[model samples]
Target: MKEVYITKISKFLPNRPISNDEMEDKLGIINGKASKGRRIVLRNNQIKTRYYALDDDGNVTHNNAQLAKEAIEQLFDENFTSSDIDLLSCGTSSPDQILPSHAAMVHGFLKCDNVEINSPSGACCSGMNALKFGFLSVKSGQTNNAIASGSERISSWMKGHIFENEIKHLQALEDNPILAFNKDFLRWMLSDGAGAFLLENEPNGETPLRIEWMEGYSYAHELEACMYAGGDKLENGFLKPWSEYKTSDWSEKSLFAIKQDVKLLSANILKKGVDSLKRALTKHDLKPSEIDYYLPHISSHFFKDKLYQEMVDNGVEIPWENWFMNLSKVGNVGSASIFLMLEELAHSGKLKKGQKILLSVPESSRFSYAYALLTVC
Candidate 1:
């Protein structure tokens, strides 16, 4: 069987680093005003600072395509041009336009011809989906060189007209304004960033990360609705069309309906994700003790203890000391998160040659999970 290796990783973060304090100020949240709830959510998420593709006045400076273009540009070397790329797989939760897919827009920006483009947009786990597509393309002898990229401009959308109107509507309707717009909580949790990885069928570069095994699982039927991106769910359980959402009054329904069932999400994510991880490990006949690092793309630090306990419950004691995260610095960049985390980890100079690493991404949008094992070579 042919193998695939990640030869390089490149990330691009915008200039602005929005701190919690800055976030509160931007939201006009005053002291002792929902302070307890704010503190709990922020502390639980373990997010101190996150980047935004915004200006000083909090206006969007860059969209998804531009961010992706910048990140992909960083992956190119003197010998590799846009023509060298056989496939471009881009995953993003928020895209610039509906017509031109994020991958196609990036392809246009790169001015490349004859390269295949795949833009898979949805929940946060699409990063792994993009990677899986590119990996299979190379592993199946269909392509020699491929680029898997993930980019997000979530901050701009979160702060856009729809959410702001929803916040106001909720505040007007409920006595406790802070808790009213509960679904808007993610506004403070997610930000902007983009990352890209160049994968080759052969070991073309020094210290390439070799892919050992990958697996995915989903438990979407476990919940009615947990997290969502487009269109509101109607009373009949069917999703409203985007055109209807655009044509109707915003007050009639939320443009982007999000129901983050904290209890359900927290309870099932770790269990489902750990089960998926165990299956991957077992398929490869590997054990927890063999992995030097466990890089998990958990959306919040609130799950840290639960995830650890879940692994222990499963009898696979991947120690907390062996695990590391960058969520505190980058927040959750949606589908771009795992790629951003991987970029920082790889460039930190902490990983060693021949060490085994496990990368897991658990997405709540559909209760989907993805797990991969990589060896530093």
Candidate 2:
């Protein structure tokens, strides 16, 4: 097998950064009432600024495909062009349309040569899945080069108008006037962005990140869904998909709104992550002490310390100094998060040759997790 190297990393954040105070103005208030959970959620997430594809008037300036296209474009140069791409893979949780795969839409916008394309669907792990696909393609000599991307245009989904119907329906039933914490909290926790990586058999750029190993695990067989959308959770924890619901109930129930089972997430997220990390470490015969940098995709500041304690308890602790995170600045871009974090670190001019970087991504959707080890060369 040929060695695969990440040649380049790029990211595209739509519009200007919207500060915390400006979020409500951009997303609007559901039923003309401020969200009681917004401030608390923001406080926990610690995201001070985030981007949106929407303009000042709440008009969409760029869709998910456009964002992915822009990020991929940054990977091209005088030596490499879109025509040189052998494969294109994209991953996202918020797609512009459901019928055409996200990669297909991105390819249409790219207008590149006829090439193989792949779209991996999931929550946060989707982006890492795309990267793993590209890595394997290049490593196995199936493709000379591959472009993988992760993006999200979730601001539009979180807009107040999308939940107005649900709020009215609930009010008419004499239930809570506002959305449940599960649905409403995410409005402030997520933002819009896209990130892409160029993978090739040969190294390029000043400091190439060689793919050492990648592994992923899903506990869905033993765990129920912790985060979901496009459906409702039944009493027994089974998800009723959008196809099973009537069209009228879609809006009335806010079936499309992203929701999370916070209690389940908090209880199992770190535990499962540590369990998966332990297995990966054992499989690769690696030690946490050997890692020079650890990039973890955490949705909130609330998990930073907890994750550390969990790792310590599991006897796989990587000290705080070895950690690198940008969540407080970029917000949570879901599937695009790990890509964005890696993009920043890759361009930060801080890496040294032979240093090892560990990437960790956990998806609360169904308690899935992905981990990758890279060596700076």
Please tell me which predicted candidate would have the highest TM-score against the true structure. Answer: 2
Off by over 4 Å in 1: 25-37, 167-181, 233-246, 249-252, 257-259
Residues 1-377, candidate 1: write the lDDT tens digits: 57999999999999767888887554444222533456667878989999888877766688888899999999887877777999999998788878888899988888877799999866787888899899989988999979998888876555534444554655667634343344556766778899999999887776789988778888766655567655665665465655665554453345654446566676677877888788888888898999898888888888888888888999888988789789999888988888988888888889889999888888887688888889998
Model 2 off-target regions past 4 Å? none
Highest lDDT model number? 2
lDDT (0-100) at residue 123 of candidate 2?
88
* Model 2 pairs whose backbones collide: none
Give the alpha-carbon lDDT of every model.
0.79, 0.94
Error of 2 at 250 (Å): 0.4
Each candidate structure's count of clashing pairs: 0, 0
Question: Could you tell me which 10 consecutive residues in candidate 2 have the lowest summed lDDT?
Answer: 176-185
TM for every model, in the order presented, reads 0.91, 0.99
